[model samples]
Target: MLQDLEAKALAGDAEAQALVHLLRLLRRKAYQEARAYAEGFPGELRERLLAGLSLLEEAPDRLEDPLFAAEREVLLGVRAVGEGRREEAEARFQRALALDPYHHRALTNLGNLYLERGEVEAALDLYQRALKLAPDDPLVHENLAALYRKKGDLDRMVAHLKRATRLKMRPPVSLDPLTGKPKRSFRIPLWVWVSLLALLAYLFLKKP
Candidate 1:
């Protein structure tokens, strides 16, 4: 149903577009819930959620839209990032930034790429640029905090973490409430659980 709706949406069906939007929202919610519940090995869930997010980030483009080309480039860059093609992703992001210097998402992702590559100063510069454009973006703050943490700069880490928490984007997950050991299960919205269970049931019932 999602694939069919996506096809119709791409073909310019308004109703299909709405359905696609709804499905995308549900998918995002489910991904968030799963991420929240993810335990020791978080890399897998993080990658999965990021991949889904990158795809959804590209879904807003209309064929003739003026921003379509830029969006496509950004999406391609994001895919390259996912594939461990850092240089390719960096080039694509640079091109996208050239097209729109104030593109906050491109800036933020570029900063994160730099951070991953151990280019702390470059990452800081890019992140600062992004923050100048979107000071309230909690993801940027969180990424910056991670960089600070890596550098052993606890003060800056705490500052950025505080900003991220203020933005309400970071889920309050930590050690166990009782023993201070890492916890596995985290709270998620009831609707997300319902949707996930429903989807699982549907898949099970449809199995051959």
Candidate 2:
């Protein structure tokens, strides 16, 4: 879907270009930047994007707009999560999914809610569905990694953790949260270093 958006944007679709840029910022969790960029557009588009960004603000009130019903539900769901209203949050996320099954954040957040309750299988299913929609979502990968670790699947955990780390631009050699083992970086063999040193020393002596 993102690829399609980018292709359309490149083909001189101004609306597609604007939406693509907005999505890029949103994917990075840059709400402020996305809002500012969205503001540059006019009319309905600006109103809709601004309304969606409002969900990320310090204290957001529910905004009613049929055009953004799904996003509005997601915002309410997130607020419910923060307020310790887990049931309410779940319902909101579910409603958002009913409105738009492809809503990636809704799927991820609902999965998180399930994971918190030790509903591992359900959470795994939701996370996988969310990943199908947004493959580059670092948060989904991180959560999925945690889920895998909880299931005692260390290899899969490490794989997803590494992918999440790379997506978030973190140091590659991070410590394993489960085993306290840091991933080792490759080093030159001792024999190679010794041979290089010996060759350099011989060259210097010959030059003298």
Candidate 3:
């Protein structure tokens, strides 16, 4: 796990380096330190890493794929969520699904919104769809664990929790730096993925 991040960080992948360093600080409940470290970054990155409320950078028009469009909406929805704009966030997530139904992040995020609104069945459906697309995404498993616990299904909840934990313990060679989450080996357009990595450097950087 460390090797992948280390290699990328050494190779000047600023996003990976930021994640590796900030995650360590945040996990230790060092919010000030995390914030300070984030401050050290230049320009928009520093702001984004501090949860600045800007729209996610637009993807290049040449991409011309619905998946990149969907990803943009998903990242924007994530930012809206951080800004506490639940209704807007819901709209954005729904729009993403309309563009590309197979978008894992959009599905998972929409499921999370539904779960928060007490729409258990709706959330379950979306989560299941997301799991189909990215079966090894630890966030999906963790979310399923939460959903099962809410339904009073202790067995299923415990199973998902354990699965998520095990996945996290393994090396995150294919980690999604945007969210600091483990991901399965699935192909995504390189430009789209890089754009996401650039815009969402703080998607998971909540105050500890």
Which candidate tops TM-score? 2
- What stretches of model 2 exceed 4 Å from their correct place? 1-29, 43-59, 170-208
In the range 1-208, model 3's lDDT, one tens digit per residue, is: 4456668989999777775666444323344555656676678767665552122233322333331355556777887999999899999889877765556778889899999999999999999998887787788999999999999999999999999999979863543434443467778989998989877776656536
Count of residue pairs whose backbone atoms collide, per candidate: 0, 0, 0
> lDDT per prediction?
0.65, 0.77, 0.71
- Ten-residue region with minimum lDDT total, candidate 2: 171-180
- TM-score-best of 1 and 3: 3
lDDT, model 2:
0.77
Comparing 2 and 3 by TM-score, which wins? 2
Candidate 1: deviation at residue 208, Å? 76
After TM-score superposition, the amount by which residue 102's alpha carbon in candidate 3 deviates from its true location, in angstroms, is 1.3
Order of candidate numbers by TM-score, starting with the best: 2, 3, 1
What is the Cα-based TM-score of model 1? 0.51
For model 1, what is the error of residue 28's alpha carbon versus the real structure, in angstroms, after optimal superposition? 15
lDDT by residue (tens digit), candidate 2, 91-168: 999997887677788998999999999999999999999999888888889988999999999999999999988887
TM-score of every model versus the real structure: 0.51, 0.64, 0.53
Candidate 3 clash pair list: none
- What shift in Å separates residue 109 of candidate 2 from its native position after superposition? 1.2
